[model samples]
Target: MSDTTHAPRAILADDERLMREQLRSRIAEVWPELQIVAEAKNGLEAVELTREHKPDLVFLDIRMPGLTGVEAARQIAQLPEDDEWAVPEIVFITAYDQYAVEAFEQGACDYVLKPAERDRLLVTVERIKKRLAQRSGEAEPDGPSNGTLQQLLHSLSARVNPGGAPKYLQWIQASVGQTIQMIPVEDVLFFISDEKYTRVQTPTVEALIRKPIKELVDELDPALFWQIHRSTLVNVKSINGISRDFRGRQLVGVKGLDEKLEVSRSYTHLFKGM
Candidate 1:
C-alpha cells in the first residue's frame, strides 16, 4: 500500500464568489491531488484562515477589501519563525497583467489572470508543487520577508489607486535613432507625449517611443512616478515640488530638468500630500 501522508493543503481567496467557485472547480478537475482546506471572501478572511489552518498554500487576490491581499500576505509572512507553522506559498490572482513582472520579482509561486483558464491554473499548480517541495526541508528562504512584501506592495500600489494616487505606466521602451532602446526602468525621470509618440526623459537625455500615454500609465512604479497631466508622467524623485502659475494652473518643476510640466485639474489630487 502507498503512504498518503504528505499531500499539500491549500486555500483560495477572492472577493468574487463566482471566481472562487470557478477556480475551485478547475483545481478539482485538473489537479485533484492538491487538497484545498479553506476559502475566503477577502484578504482579512484569508489571513485569518491562514493563521487558523496553517495551510501549505494560499491563492491570494491582488486587490481586496479591509486589508489588501499584499497586506495580508505581509502579515502572514510575519508569523513567528517557528516549526509549528509552515510558510504558505502565495499565488496571486489579478485582473491586470502589468503586475506579472513585479509578482515574479517578489517570489510569488505563480499568478493567474482573472477569468481563470484551466491551462494556466494547471501550470501555476505545477509551479506551486515544485516550490513546496523545495521548501519542505528548509526554514524560511534566505532573503528578508519584509523586503519581499515591500516590493510586492510597491508594485501593486503603482497599478491601483488606493486614495487618489496616480496610476503607473504599463510598459515603456525608447527609440534612439535607428536602434530601439529599452529604458532601464530606474533611470526614467518622466514621460511626455508629442504628436504620435511619447517621449521618455531620463536623467541624461530624452528619447521618443511609440506607446500611448494612457496604457503606459498602468506600468510605472506608482511611488516613483506621478501623472501630473494627461500628457506627462513625472518621477517623484525628480519633482522639486508643485507651484501655481498666474492663471492658477499647477506646474511641476523637475530638479535636473529645466522643463516645467503642467498638472491638469483632473489629476491635481495626486499632488495633494507632496
Candidate 2:
C-alpha cells in the first residue's frame, strides 16, 4: 500500500453492501475531503484493493468472507515498501464488542461500530485526519508504524479463534441426481452458488449442494478456496490464468476446465490491473 499523495484517499471493505454504502455516506458527512476511491465486499478484496490503490487509509469490517479484517491488516502491514507510496493506515469497523479490549490495547488501531454514530465517526475521522496531517508534514512519509499495532493485531487474530482454527471442510457432500456423493475439497475446481443450490465443479464430475455460499465460506479454508465473487469460490491451485472481455470485466481460467469464472468488480483488485 502507498500514500504518496498529500490529498487523502481511503477505501471501505465489507461484505454487506448496505453497510459499506452507509459507512461511505457517513464518512462523507464527517470528512468531506476524504475521497473513497474504491469499495470491497470481502476481506480478500480489501487486501487486493489496498495494494492496487495505495490509499491513505483503509476502513475494514472485522468479519468478512475468506479473510478476516485483522488478517487483512496483517497483510497490509507486511506489504513491500514502495518509493512511490507508503502503506495506508488501518481502522476497524465492527459491531462485535468482544474485540474492544484487544483493539484498544496500547491504543493500537481506531475503530467504529456497525451503525457508526455521527459523533463517534467524527472522533475517528478527526484522529485519522490528524495522523495523515502528521505524515504529510514529515519530510519522508512512511506508513503508520507502531509496534503496539502489531501486538494488537496478533492479540485480535488469536482472539478470533481462541481455541484453535476449526478443521476446514475437506470433503464436500453433494447430491448427484438421487445419490449423495462425497467430493474431496482439494479435487474440486470451483464452487458457484445461486439462491437454491451451489454447483461444485471438478475435473471428472460436477455436483450440487444445498449449502449456500455464505455458509460454505465459513466451512472452507480461505487459503485454499479464494473467493472470486460473492457467490463463487475458486481453488487457488486450479487457477490457470486470467483474461478479459470487451466490457473490461476480468475472468479467471481454471485448470482442467475450459470455462473462465467471472471476477466481480469487488475482486478485480486481486488481479492487479483490472
Candidate 3:
C-alpha cells in the first residue's frame, strides 16, 4: 500500500489554454493526489515558477513564446546543487510528435501527447509515485542522466507503423526560389527546423517549406515519421543507428542523410525496453 497522506506537487506549462485545462482536469480526475502549484504559458515562466515553488513535477511544453522548454530545462539544471530547488521530474506536453523522443532523452519523466488519453496519464502518475517511493530516503535528489534520456528518445521516435488505421499525408506544393515543387510525405527523409519554416529532406534533395515543425507533425504519419528533437523529425525507416559523440551527446545517423541529428537527453525515454 502507498501513503495517501502526502500529495505530490506539480506545475503545468503550455501555451494553449484549452490544452492546459484539459490536462489539469484529467490530472484531477485520475491522480487527484497531485497538487498543481503553478501554471505558465511558456518556458521562461515555467523556469521562474519552478524556482519559486520548487514543485516535485513539471509538465512543460517543448516550444513556447519565449525560451523553449529544452533550453529552460538546461538553465534550471545549472542552478547550484545546494539550493532549495530539488530536481523536478519533467513530463513534456505537446501536440507535436517529433519532440516526443527528444523529450524523453532530456530526462523528462514522461511525454504526454496533446489531448492526452486518460489511461496514459494514469500510467504516468503511477510511475511518478514509484519514483518518489524509491527516493524517499535519499538526500541528494536523483534524476535521469542526460545520455540515457537521449538514447530512449531515439528508440521511441523510431517506432514505425504504430498499430492503427493508415493515416495518409496531405500533399504540399511550395515555391523554392524560382522553382515551384510538389512533394509527397512518403519521399521525405525528415523535417529540419529552419527559423520560421521547416526544411523537408528527401532522398535526393532538400526543399524549404513554409510550414512550421508543429504543422508538419500533424500532417506527417506518426507510424512513418517522428519528431526526435524540437528542431528535427526523421522517418523511422530512414534512421541508420544512434551513436555517442565525444561530448556524450547522442547523434542519430539516417540513411541517405549526411548530417547527424542531435537527440537531446530529455527525450531519451522513448528508446527504453526496445
Candidate 4:
C-alpha cells in the first residue's frame, strides 16, 4: 500500500502574484497529490500561515518583504515541538542562476527555480515523495535537521543580502491609563491585542499601545517572542509551562501572570512536548 494515499498538504509563498499562481499550477500538475492548504504573498504571512496550517511542506520564495524565505523557514523549523505534528519540509524557490541552484542541490537542500520548469520540479516532487515515505512509520518525520538548515541559511544569506542581521524593536512606549511609559522589550511578559490597542504586560506593570499584534510581529525578534495566537505574542523566557484545559486545548502559563494564555489549534505546534 502506498503510504501517501492521503494527500500531503502544503503552503506556497511568493511576493509576486503571477509567480505564486504559476508555481501552484506547476505543483498541481507534477504533484497532484499535494493539496495546497494556504498561499501567502510575503514571508511574514508565510510564517503565519505555516504556523496555522502546519502543512506537510512549504515552498518559499527566497526574497520577500518583511522576512525572506530563509528567515521564515528558520522560524518554521524552530517551532516548539509538538510530537503530534512534524515540521514541514521546506523547498526554496528563487530566481537565482543555475549555478546557485546547483549549489543548493550540493548542500542537500531542495529548490525550484523561477517559472518552475516541469522537468526540474518533477525531480523535486519525486525526492519529497521518497522522503515522506521514509518518514511514514517513524517516531520522527524525515527532513533536514534544524542545525543543518540553519547553516544552509547562513551560507545563502550572502547571496540574498550582504548586510547585517535584522534588528528588532528595542523598546515599547505605551499608555498606563493616564501615564505614558516606556517598556523595555526584555521586560515584557506578553502582548495581547484588543479591539483598538495591544496590551503590554510585565511583572510589575500593564500598559496599552495602539499598535496591533500584526505590526508587533514585524518589530519583535522571533527568537524572543512567540505567537501563540493570532492576537497574542508571549516572551519565550516568560513561559513557565503548558497545560491542557477541559476541552484538550493548550494553555500557556507565564512566570508571573494569573491568567494562562490559550493556544489556538492552529498554533498548538508551538508547544509540542507539553
Candidate 5:
C-alpha cells in the first residue's frame, strides 16, 4: 500500500532460523507482493537491520539473548526522523503462554502467535494493509499513543514472570555511600526522575536508585504509587491534598514534603474532584 511503485519491504527478526523461514514462507503466501528485505537473529540485530534497511514493516520476537523484543521496538520507535521516512509498522511474533497472549487484546500492535495460523494471519494482514494505506496518504493515520505502547510493553514484560502475573516490589534496596539500605515501599513518599537516576524519598530520609519511573511503574503497585506527572510518582497514602497553582496547574501536595509536584495536564484527571 506504500507508494504503488513497488511492494513494501519488511524485516523478520527471531532467534530460530527455522521459525523465521516458516514465517517468511507464510507471509509470502498471504501477502505475495510484500518484499522480505532482511532477517535478523537477535534484538540488537533487529534494530541494526531496521536502521540500515528502513523497511516499511518489522516483525520482532519478544525474547532474545541480550536485548528483548520490546526493547528493540523502543529503539526502533525512537530512530532518527527524516522528511522522507515514516516509522515502520511493527508486529510482534510471540510464543507466549495463552494467558500472556491475552495482553494483545488492547490492539497496540499487530501480532502473530507461534506456528502462525493462516486464517488469523489473514485478518491481521488485512488490518495492517489498511493502516499502510492510511500512511500512504490515502486517509488519516490512527495508531496507539506512545504511553499506550509503553503500557503494552510493560504488560508483555510482566509475562516473563511465572503465571503471567507481575510480582510488585515490596522493598527497595538502595546504596548510600558505604551502606546499603533496605527501604520498605510503604515508607516512600515519592519518586522523581533525575536523568539516569530515580530519587526515592521517604518520610525520614531519601535515597537514589538506577531504576527509572517507567520501569518502576510495573514493579510497584499502581493503586499505591499513582503517577501524577511524567517524571514523578507519589505514594497514594503519603498524599495530603491536591491544590492548584496560580497558573491554574494542578499541584499535588505530599505529606511531610515541602515541595509540591506539578501535575501535567495528561494526569490532572487523577486528581479530579468527586
Candidate 6:
C-alpha cells in the first residue's frame, strides 16, 4: 500500500450538469478519499482547472462547448511544470463506442463510459489506485506526455475523416447600442457571455451579440482564440501576460486593457507556463 499521508485530488469536466453530478457521486462511492477540487463545463475549463489545482487525476468529457477533450488533454500534457504539481492522470469520459475505447487502450490511457455503471467505475477506480500505489515515492514520469497526446489526437482525427477541415469565423456583426458594428475577428480581444448576450471586446469597440459563447465557439478559430472559461474566449494575440490575483485565480492581461480578464479555474492550463 502507498503512504496514506497524501490524499489524491481530481477534477471533472463535462458540459452537462447532470453528468458531472452523476460522475461525482459515483467517484465518491468508489474512491472516498479522492477529493474533487473543481468541475468544468467544457474542455478549455478542464485544461485550466488542471493547471490551477494540479490534481492527481482528471475526467474529461469527449465533447464540450469550446475545446474537445482530446484538445484539452494535449495542452494539459504539454503544460510546463514548475514542480508545483505533477501532470494528472487522464480519464476520458466518452459516450459508449467500441472504436473510442480501442483508441484509448492503444494510448494506454484510462477511460469511463458515460452514464457510468458502478462496476465499470469500480474497475477504473481500482486501476488508478493500483497505478498510484506503484508510483509511490517515485518521480512523476508515468502520466502521458504532449507527444503521446498529440499522436493519439492525430490518430483519432484521421479515423474521423481525412482531409477535412473546419471553416472558422472571419468577421462578426455585433450591435453597439444603436449601431451595428462589423468587427473583424482578428481585432477581437475577447468574448464574454452574459446570459443571453455575449459581450465582444476589442481595442476600440465593445459590442454585444445575441449568440451565446457555446454557439460562437463553433464559428471561431481554435488556434487564434482560446476559451479560458465557460463564458470567456480570448484572442491568443491580444494576451500580454497572465498573473494571479489575491485569491490565487489566474487573470489574463490584454495588450491595451486596464482591467485584467479573469481566467476561471477550469481554463488555467492556457497560461500554465506563465
TM-score per candidate: 0.53, 0.59, 0.50, 0.55, 0.54, 0.55
Candidate ranking (TM-score, best to worst): 2, 6, 4, 5, 1, 3
Identify the runs in model 6 with alpha carbons over 4 angstroms from their true place.
1-5, 138-146, 157-274
Per-prediction tally of clashes? 11, 1, 24, 2, 0, 6
lDDT per residue for candidate 6 within 1-274, as digits (tens), equals: 2242489888999876657777898898988999999999888999989888787788887656577676777778777665345567778887635537765576446888766788999988877776665456544546455467668866654543336666355567577886555578999999999887889999999888777898878779899999999999999999998888899888889999987889887787778767
Top-TM-score candidate index: 2
- lDDT (10s digit) by residue, model 5, range 116-141: 77887787788778777777787687
Worst 10 residues of 5 by lDDT: 95-104
Locate the minimum summed-lDDT window of 10 residues in model 6.
156-165
In model 1, how many backbone clashes occur? 11
What are the runs in model 5 whose C-alpha is more than 4 Å off? Answer: 1-5, 97-103, 161-274
lDDT of 1: 0.72
Cα RMSD to native, each candidate? 12.3, 15.3, 16.7, 17.6, 16.4, 16.2
Better of 2 and 5 by lDDT: 2
**Order by lDDT, highest first:** 2, 4, 5, 6, 1, 3
lDDT of each: 0.72, 0.79, 0.68, 0.79, 0.77, 0.77
| lDDT by residue for model 3 (121-226), tens | 8878877776666555423445576455445434433332135333345344444554545566678888888786678778886777666778667657788887
**Location of the lowest summed lDDT over 10 successive residues in candidate 4:** 99-108
Which lDDT tens digits does candidate 2 get at residues 1-274? 2343556889998765656777898988988988899999778898899888888899988877678889888888777766666667788987666786557555567888766788999988877776776666644443345566777888888876666776366566566775556577999999999988899999998888767888878878998988889999999989989998899879999987779899999988887953
